[model samples]
Target: MMTERSIREAKAGDKAFILWDSQIKGLGAKIFPGGEKSFVLSYRVNGAKRLSTIARVSELSLKAARERAGQELVRIRSGETDPLERRREAREAPTVNDLWDRFLTEYAPERITLGRMTTGTLKDYRNQAHRYLLPVLGRMKVRDVRRTDIERMARIMAHVPVQRNRTLAFASRLFTVAEHWSLRANYTNPCRGVVRAREEPRDRILSDSELAALGKTLTSLADRYPVPVNVIRFASVTGFRIMEAAGIQWSNINFERGCVTLPQTKVGRQVRALPPAALELLKSMPRINDCDFVFTTTGKVSVAYKHLDEVFKMVCQKARIENVRMHDLRRTVATTAAGQGVGLTVLRDLLGHKTVQMAVRYARQADSAVAAAVEQTGGNIASAMGVKPKAKIVHIRKRRHG
Candidate 1:
């Protein structure tokens, strides 16, 4: 039993001794050898027993201490709150790294992307964190992150505008994932207001002359470096994105159907229609060492990124082409197809674009082919309507669209 008078006269021992109160099951006075005394509350919360120090005996009378203990015990019995968890959280808020770790290990793999992210998305996220985000803001508490931090990161990597924007996007997502994980106290996504640099869409299309020169160069390289030439020619003719070209396996090619079924694309699985020229090109490629991939330099493995880039650069130099990228060849095909009066929907499907809006850019290039198509469409419409040859609609005029 512990009273105000008895607590004062209590002698300190070699170690701490807990003096339990007879009236209260959980109320006690902890007397230490150092002459310190404190009130404690013992109770079970949600099936777990808890022994929590309420206050120093000097701060409150024994009566008050007992009442406080009673209140805490009552609250725990009624299932109101758990102070232990709240205390733990306040003491140990997760850092950005902690949240990212869970994202890599648990969340990313379990998440249902429905075919948006690449197979390498997890690896890419880790690489992004290691290369950029982690170095600048890894140690900061997730709850304390602000929009200014993301914007500051953008300015830091302004030299690499693309990577800067990408980092901002990825960091903003950290908060989104953290909210569900309860990693941070704050719910606001910090990347909302970070201004991204204006980036010019790389829509560079190869001209006919440039294409002819490239074809000649590729033909010359065909004997010496056959694989690189075939890869370039296949991509140029089929309008496949660089990876879509590089990652193609013989299994993906359906000779009977005259199309390649890509199991994993940027958006999802897609089937690209191959023209007669492209089919003939695929037919001409030689198989190597039982490797499934159609575009491998080594019989056992795919061509290295550096090796592919080096050879492509050499081919471009031989063609006397300046600043033309591998992806530009794809744009050239889209533009040429559009100019030849290929409909927007057809073009979208052909390029594996997610929406027709993405294909609208090609509409701006109204070349002679499109102009000729407009004349043909108008004349056909006039004939279908039973209009005379001299009708006012027979003359083809410039319109907003083909």
Candidate 2:
């Protein structure tokens, strides 16, 4: 047996040596010339000998060290595991930071090239990882991370429910990729079972009056910021996403076909039918020399996303529109189309959505339109039936005596 007194009183020699425990086979206390001490376990498996450090003397008492060594010895004898090899593998495991780097350099770009992921989504993932995931979990081994770790991150970001939910989604995606890459075990994703914060979907849409005001503001500012103003108009008329509108080239337009063909979008390739108003808007845009884009500030590239957003914000402020985003313009287009009796399938195509479910919300607006039409029909029928209207009773107050 290895006693605490023996371990404490053991003298350092000129060379490091282990004092084997008499009671527990293969368990020993290693004493180094530098006066350091640790408990080590030596064992053989399949005719091969290996040594694993159980713990430092300062970390475990003699009884604790004996129990650990006995457990490891039993596992080795049963041919179930090798303690040395397991420790070695753990030491070589990839950390979350490594997984993140691989995700960015391998998984994300590959998915982007395959059209399964969009650049905008990639930008958001990068932003969320840097702002939340990497700071806390980066140092942890990929396989060692638990659900509690992810839940802690979510709790830390609970104040911003939208951001917290997005971060959790991003972390979930990273771990899924890690499993695909064999860096983590399948079905062991730490993000699993972690509760995500509830997020409210944005449903803001610009009304007709607000749209008119916005158009007026754009016209007033067009002379000062032609490209951004035109870009906004294009997005509004086509119901295109902000990035989709900003990335459009002149070559994408077909005046004869009256459509624009996008080789890549959030949902992949799409051909959107352009109304005459949209075509006329495109026709009026002055093309810069040697510029391939429909909207450009330097003639070398399309208008930057940030600049377009800032210009839109300024235009909205001048138009006196409240609580409206540029994306609301896209919603407005969908709502207008739905109210005009456009079916769900056509709305899906118009919005370049992959599924008809994405266009289903606009069905409610169409239903409201139907209800108004029915109310009008009912009024006409009532008049035809000669239904008498209720007489109004006016209340009068008599003068008070002085």
Candidate 3:
């Protein structure tokens, strides 16, 4: 039997021992030789005995300790696993930080090597993880993360909607992979129902006058920065991504076939047709000795993407063109081709798009082609009506109005 007076008068002996409570089967007060006291529960599970410290005796009254021990015993009898063991497992569980390391080193690289992801996309994932995801969720146990945690992260990054959406996507992928890795349970992804931020698709393209201005600027810069200038020119004519243009090796080019084959790209392997103008431009390039790249800052490596972008910015400034990006050059090529009566299917192949829908955006920008078709149709109609197609307009001064 245990009472508050007995618990208080209990003295530490030469050895530590526990005084069992008469009312609670497994509840006891453990007295240590150092005079320290704690409430403990002694129980058995599957024939093996176990003792778990509930709390310090000084931390709880007799009534409170009995209530806690009784609840734990009831939970055990009702088929719950050992609470102490569950806590131990939780303490050793993998965290978001561990998942992040595996994702970056194992998952991302494997996908990249298999051509399922691009290096650029991997870079973006790294940025999103370090800048947003890790800061909030790194120390949390993978299995314990909830939808509220993910939504809170999204709210924290609400200012940059696009980046916030990207981070959310990254986190979603992380949780999904964690499930596969057994770091978390199945179907327990926290980002499942989270809403992504809205994003407006960019449709900016360089007009004919803008292209001419850009061309003039490139001509002026060609003497000093020939590699970047030619790289930009290649992008404009062939609609290659800037990195694709920069990474072109001489071995990838087939002048006889008039094409360049890229072994790997954002979408995978692609072969782009090289027009006569593009082929001529390639011939005029000065090849460095022992260099395989078509454009190079040094003989060993190709011109970097950063260098190309910086030069493009300078050229745009010199040309006085605003709101034009390097990627818009690729769009300009697609639009120009569309204006020349190129069909959607052909445009898809020209732009190396997997589907015609991706090329349809450029079709809407073919205003010149539309105008030309309308003019030709009207001229044929007039000719069929016995009216001269080229009637000159003679404007006479309007009679003075009284």
Candidate 4:
């Protein structure tokens, strides 16, 4: 019912009115310079107000906008109003990487170590996002992302179950940042409904023969790179993370107390008691005049990032071990402690695990001792049952073939 003449006459004050454009049929231009464009129809939606534009003016004609508005109004009158909710839903969604950056800037710097763990986590997020999420939704507005896209990415990661699950978990936490930063208004995470891949089992315990070979290889490497060799050896004995071991300062050790104080770890600050073997190893290392670190690469408490990878790779190759990693040394320490009948609570404190489940992993690794008992019994079930075990053997095996 709105015509160009009536529209002009109806514009009494600063209020906006629609003018029909002859270039396009059913096209009504909003005369207001800064206001939402909506279709002018015969009746209002729910008799409340005129239905707004179905799409942007750049994309939809006035005719198309009018058609969409009419359809929406028909639904509105039926008490089925979901278009606004749908628009809100799309705008509330955001990707995991979006929230991760917020967490990194707001929380991580103040609370966590800036060494390998933090850097490694950021690196992992970048790699995973680039590999999967970025490809699909990088250019999409964070608030406009859809749950279907997230679910599809999860399905694609099924080929790598462990990494997939980890990636999803990371996404879940990253998206959780929206609640804090107000990047998105919604409280729900998009990954909340997505199915995660199954956790893959890894029985990565090293056997006795493997340990002997590794010891020999480490001894040989001592001639070439004594510092890193000692570092690896110390890590194996103490169960400290490589970065923590590398960052160990003289101030952290107490020869008299027979314990090392770690002011901070991956989870938080903790104290670890040095066993006799580890204590002796610390004593054997040469002390420097001004250096504070127990292991110094360039006269500092922290090791140089570049040299660590080379040293670790060379030692693994020499030991004929494939896939043996620096973190496994922490596992070795936990396994050894568990074999000594250390309780899960004590082990959790020693390793600075925030959760008991992490300590349980070490217990599971120590469970290989059952196999050792079976071997000693010569496969005799009754012999295994009656005899008291003489000694706990935690064998660390090296792979013979690289």
Best by lDDT: 3
Off by over 4 Å in 1: 1-87, 90-92, 111-114, 120-124, 185-187, 366-402
User: What residue pairs are clashing in model 3?
Assistant: none
Model 3 residue runs over 4 Å out of place are 2-19, 29-39, 44-49, 55-81, 367-402
The local distance difference test score of model 3 is 0.89
lDDT of 1 by residue, 1-402 (tens): 678988888889999988889998978888889999998877776577887888998899999988888887787778767556656775688788887888877777665365656755555677779988888788888887888887766777888887777777778787888877766545588887778876656657788899999999999988888877788888899888877887788988999989999887866888889999989988988899899888788887666556667778999999899999888888889889888788999999989998999888876653644676788898899789997676444545565432
Per-candidate TM-scores read: 0.69, 0.87, 0.80, 0.68
Give lDDT for model 4. Answer: 0.68
Give Cα distance to truth, residue 95, candidate 3, Å: 1.8
Tell me the tens digit of each residue's lDDT in model 4 across 1-402.
544344444433367766654533434656454554444433344445442435555566545666676576567667774466556766765554555555667665654554324554666677776787667666565655567878878878777888888777766766666655666557667777777765645556555666787788888878778778777788887777887777777878999989888776655567788878888988987777579887775665566544666887787787788877777777767887898899999998877788888899788777777567767666476466776557765677654442
- Score residue 107 of candidate 4 by CA lDDT: 62
lDDT of each: 0.81, 0.88, 0.89, 0.68
| Ten-residue stretch with the least lDDT total in model 1 | 393-402
Cα RMSD, each candidate: 9.1, 7.9, 8.4, 9.2
TM-score, cand. 3 vs. native: 0.80
Candidate 4: segments with Cα more than 4 A from true spot: 1-102, 113-136, 286-289, 304-306, 380-402
Best by the TM-score measure: 2
Q: Candidate 2: where are CA atoms >4 Å away?
A: 44-49, 77-84, 366-402
